[model samples]
Target: MPVVTVASLKGIYPPIATPFADDGTLDDNKMISNIKRWSSATRLSGIVCQGSNGEYVLLSTDERVHQVKIVREHMPAQWQLIVGTEAGSTAATIDMTKRVAAVGADAALVLTPSCYKSRMSDEAIISHYTSIADASPIPVILYNMPANTGVDLSVAAICHLARHKNIIGLKDSSGNVVKMATVRKKTDKNEFSLLAGSAGFLLPALSIGAVGGVCALANIAPQLCCDIQEAFDTGDFHTAMAHQHRAVEINTAVTSQFGVPGLKYAMDMLGLHGGPCRAPLVRLTDDEKRKLDAILRDSQVQHTERIHDR
Candidate 1:
């Protein structure tokens, strides 16, 4: 059996963005500071490390493992730590999973292996996840980030993977609630968790039996994201829709609209440590930043409480 069942794995988790200094180096101290503030967000369930938002592709193997160790040490114990140990090869992923589990991660978030996109068949994906789940010391969460990987895990693939006791859940970022519902219908809820990959569809995802979200918007608006889930659970659709409406634009701005650069900029504006992105990804221009600022102001996410230790 998995360490924790999907039933217990529901809530808003931020796919933490890896903080890099101007020199393109990991700033562990800065990241630790950010995690401390996130600890104060209302109803925040856990922290997700090294998903797309974490810039997992840009870091070295050593850096990925090292950051997981750093986050687990600093974040609150109550928060579950789900580390993304995704690698193109199954052997590499399995090796990384064990390393993270040794450090204190609650679960491993494994993305689809898309380097060989053409050959990533349903059978291939099923084999990859099953093999990793069998070998991993901790339970595994299948990550279906089609935007980044260009390979969406089919419902058939998900249903097959869900049967593995160690393969606990999925984070579907395709934003297709219909597809999400189909997966929910085919799989046993007790055995599988369907998490909204982004906050854009978190409510709709939940409406169709999703547990929660691993949202990029949660990185900027933790309380806002958490409120959506909290409101919906309590039968307050009006407030939930209010949060969801705000989430739609903010999520689009950070995720599909501007990608990581815009997300980091928004963090910097709101007193968070969303500094530079690693090379191959550039920062936003002055005009783009102005537009983002306007959007934020319009949505009333103008400022945060701004936490700091004396």
Candidate 2:
């Protein structure tokens, strides 16, 4: 198969939240409906399945594969579907990535090796990713979410990996704007792409030359996310900054403060189905919901007064 490039994966692609059934299972129908809805709402280059916000670690391997199949079957053909193949071990990650590639996913977003944080050096990360990128059928995007991984791929390490023919881009979720800028300055402008992992920092990252984003904010507000990118693309700086601020507020509520359940609740409020999150990932408290409502309203996400109707 021909390799897909980082530039090919550019734009505001949502690492979409996986919707669930009331029984707390992967809701295939709801997911299908949501994917179709989001695809229609924005100019997303693709959708990323089983990403961190998707609670991928909570899913079984079979279920992950199944979800990818469902998204591909229902999503528009023009939209590329990227799969998160991050695992605790190289063997498992590679096995899962190959299986995902076999299922026709456009690319695999591989997280940095993180189980034994003390042992994960730059060489270790490079070797782990290089091995996978070399062996996998599809191209690889380095997923750098240090907040979760406890390990970060530095600018030098990323620039080295970016030079590889198969390691196309890195999703920097570190929230370190300076590191983002450094990476942008160090990497070859034409060959490698840098994507902001959080919508909260999309404009700042973009202002420094990020090509796109794999934003969590896009899960609940796809059109708004696209609008931010569109505004920047059209040189509408004022609109972009305003949208970015809104994105930061929403992200704080759903991610930094409210967690997965809050994101699901926000989704439910916004006309999308964000059913109960799976076990071990409990529902948001009523008090928390009340707080989320205030935040959403403040962000204008709850302007319609239908927080639960949808």
lDDT, each prediction:
0.89, 0.83
The CA lDDT at 80 in model 2 is 78
Model 1, residue pairs in steric clash: none
Candidate 2: 10-residue stretch with minimal lDDT: 301-310
Q: Write the per-residue lDDT of candidate 2 for residues 205-290, one digit (tens) a residue.
A: 88998888998778877667777889999999999988787778888788778878888888888888887887788888899989
Candidate whose TM-score is highest: 1
lDDT of 1 by residue, 85-197 (tens): 99779999999999888888889999999999999999999999999999998889999988888999999999989999998899999999999999999999999998999
Whose lDDT is greatest here? 1
Local error of candidate 2 at residue 91 (angstroms): 1.3
Residue pairs of candidate 2 with colliding backbone atoms: none
Alpha carbon deviation, residue 257, candidate 2 (Å): 1.0
In model 2, which regions exceed 4 Å deviation? 1-3, 302-310
TM-score of each: 0.96, 0.94
